[model samples]
Target: MIATLIKLLIGLLLWVGLAIVAARIVFALPRVQDRIDSTALDPADVGPLAATLRVRARGQEGKTGIAMLRDGADAFAARIMLADAATASIDAQYYIWHDDLTGYLLLDALARAAERGVRVRLLLDDNGTSRLDAELAELDAHPNAEVRLYNPFNLRRFKLASYAFDFFRLNRRMHNKSFTIDGRVTILGGRNIGDGYFGTGPAALYVDLDALAVGRVVPEVSADFDRYWAAPCVHPVGPILGQARRDGAIEDGLAHYADDPQLEEYLEILEGSEIVTRLSAGDLDLEWTEAALISDSPAKGEGAARREDLLSARLLKAVARIESRFDGISPYFVPGRAGARAFKALRKRGVSVRMLTNSLEATDVLPVHAGYTSKRGTLLRRGVKLYELRRKSASRTPADTLGRFGSSGASLHAKTFAVDGKRIFVGSFNFDPRSTMLNTEMGLLIESAAFAGNLHDAFDRELDGLAWRVEMDGLKTVWIDPESGEVTRDEPGTTFARRVVLRVIGWLPVEWLL
Candidate 1:
């Protein structure tokens, strides 16, 4: 029995050693260690799109026209409509694009746009886009459509092996989300391409926000996208995923599912939405403002980026310009010791620093919540006000609005903040270490008191009903329900099983990964 046990241990060791060797060999064989270069086409003079936008901006030079898309349905509609309207080029990049209702819907629009001779480019991080290999390959095969994967995994089938070999590089991701069409309009913010983001899916819904932008910012957005598109970490689908067999609907070039009951409802909602109609007519109600894009360099993933190229540095510069109040909204809030000290300094200087993030009960990524909990005491003790969003019901959400892709409002996903009630930021940046050091992020910093005040106002009024306040009773933490003035000693709406998961993950030394 002792000899048999020794043999078993030897066999396991041999297998593990062989697996590691194979993984490293596979990782080096691909373009993961190499750079691919490609040039992006200039924004075409897309007839009606440019003509109408030009008329609208006849007098507004060097200013961006921005419109808020707080409603999930409106955000979804805006993307679909823009895709359909594009006659020149489309550039879209995202961290997550689920293989669900909304994902397919948007892909269909892109494929249709490609059929009509429009240039379509889709750049997605390989991390969050599992089970999308076949569809992505098909899209890439299209003459007018191209797809690129960022920081991709070479061992597609054996992801574990890939991670084992290249965990350091794979850990960093491109978390930027932006969609530009005809080089004239762009939609950007916290939402990824997923059902939960748009309020539909089996997963819990995300409280999200997006901004449809045009004018001066569009060029900036396009230029920034070009930099990422030409980054060394990016790879074409052909080299990594290989060629896909053009079959089924893609081969036959079938028509869209306009008649499908699931898609029809959303089409009806789009027809009724004011965004698409006003956008096409050049009469969209957009606020003109001076907007600056803050983004991390594509080189950040390789740890070779300059400090000045980081989004955090740009944000700190922006924050330095603030005087009185600051409201930071992030679903994944993991303020490390450094962030705590910074906030403490801000507090000492009389800045009313407030933050809104997911509560334990409302957070979908429980591990992130664990990381956030570690800093709560430090932040609250240092005079930073914290609000945790509650898991909300679907009473306010419409079935048709989200379609089959909708979800219950169970988490906060919007990453935005108001600075001194004069400047506001909205984008895919989360206030966590991952966003700071492990991922590339982008957002618009608008110099508009009105837009910034809207966020501050919501925190004072609407958020009181949607979120609970986190306070400290000496050294003990408690949650206060603002609506009923009820205080709870433990996390609100959390189950015993979930608490166990949270505790287990909290004990793990994985704060850097969060």
Candidate 2:
């Protein structure tokens, strides 16, 4: 009888544990939805708005050079802001806005706009800024600037357990970048705000990329921002600020940070870039062409309510369109068998697919390479053009810190693709399971012969100089280990165990969750 009682107790405990987990999952969703819904704004009609916001370029014609591709971060930011100022309203969003020197400068600019009543709305991912609650409150104090966090961890309610319990929520991040100004011009691509993004870091500056669009497409970017603002993912600053109850504490803190020397220098460097001057004058010269605004969210096509998000749907569309040539560059590429198969299909259709991704030695996430290496055979078999970027030569000198500071140990973090040398895409969508199935992503598809040609030339330069071209051998192929810079013939015995392990783990299908 005692034994029976013990068994019953054990079973009851197990059931309760399961119940708690399920309850927690259910509890988290509404909180996420409430935050997303609060900031929702009506999507403005961008066509009529575009003309009013469009600023014609004037004054000195700047020197156009191929080297401008490596323009510094300060230059990029300043240029975009100048393009944005021509707008009637500006909407900017990102995952991280650091508290460092660069962060304050950008914040100050936004604050100035708010003071001018530029109708500025800034949406930031909560996980990246969770620790900066106090800092955010100060920025929000800008009368025209309203800042909100997407799926924030409510420090007041959740408290000590919040960090631990909020892991799941933290995983589904909003990895989108869009800056729409005056409802006319937009810059959409894979940059976040920080020293790392702007080349002002102590480490190497990343070879990142962004796109400038002017015409019918800016509105689509605006619509996506409005959707997220109103979605259940974003939460207002009121509740968290109210909980902190620091009152004017945030505003004062922002003022102090805004005056820091690092920020002042960063801003100065930015304003001095030729690109900044050109963009400020609204002088982007290009023929208007086809473009599409793509956004990824757990709530994808069916919108935010459904269980499966639309990131994959948009990706598949991009892939299907790649029925011709598949040219891609992603910071992270862990192509599983499924991803390999997709590439294979393109190859079968006689598409010349070339990809450039980070080397394992340069990759920040080693485990992702573990997944990528396992699938190289499939990619090579499909005749896809594959290349991995080497760490830039240490002997190379600095070009211009127009993008960001720091240039010693940078790795590639760009997510871009060009199809048929006509259509191109750039944004936060990495070619990995996380981007496909978990985190919400965003990118802009630009159909511009001019822009596409420019990007194609850039890709060629990287292919010839910075990338290690992957090629096939007889029955086997060649694998180049980045760390060693040694080429080894791919035979039966090369890391076979590692391949087996990856196959087993990848077969589980939970990597998308990971």
Best by lDDT: 1
Question: What lDDT score is found at residue 215 in candidate 2?
Answer: 53
Instruction: State the lDDT of candidate 2 residue by residue for 180-249, as single tens digits.
Output: 6665556767777766666654645666777666556666677778787876557777665644446554
Q: What is the lDDT of residue 495 in candidate 2?
A: 67
| Candidate 2 TM-score over all chains jointly | 0.77
What 10-residue stretch in candidate 2 is worst by lDDT?
A: 59-68
lDDT of 1 by residue, 402-510 (tens): 1222344567788989988888898989989899988999999988888888788766663646678889998899988777888999888678887787778778889
Candidate 2 lDDT for residue 406: 48
C-alpha lDDT values of all predictions: 0.81, 0.61
Clashing pairs in 1: 199-406, 199-407, 200-405, 200-406, 200-407, 201-405, 201-406
TM, every model: 0.90, 0.77
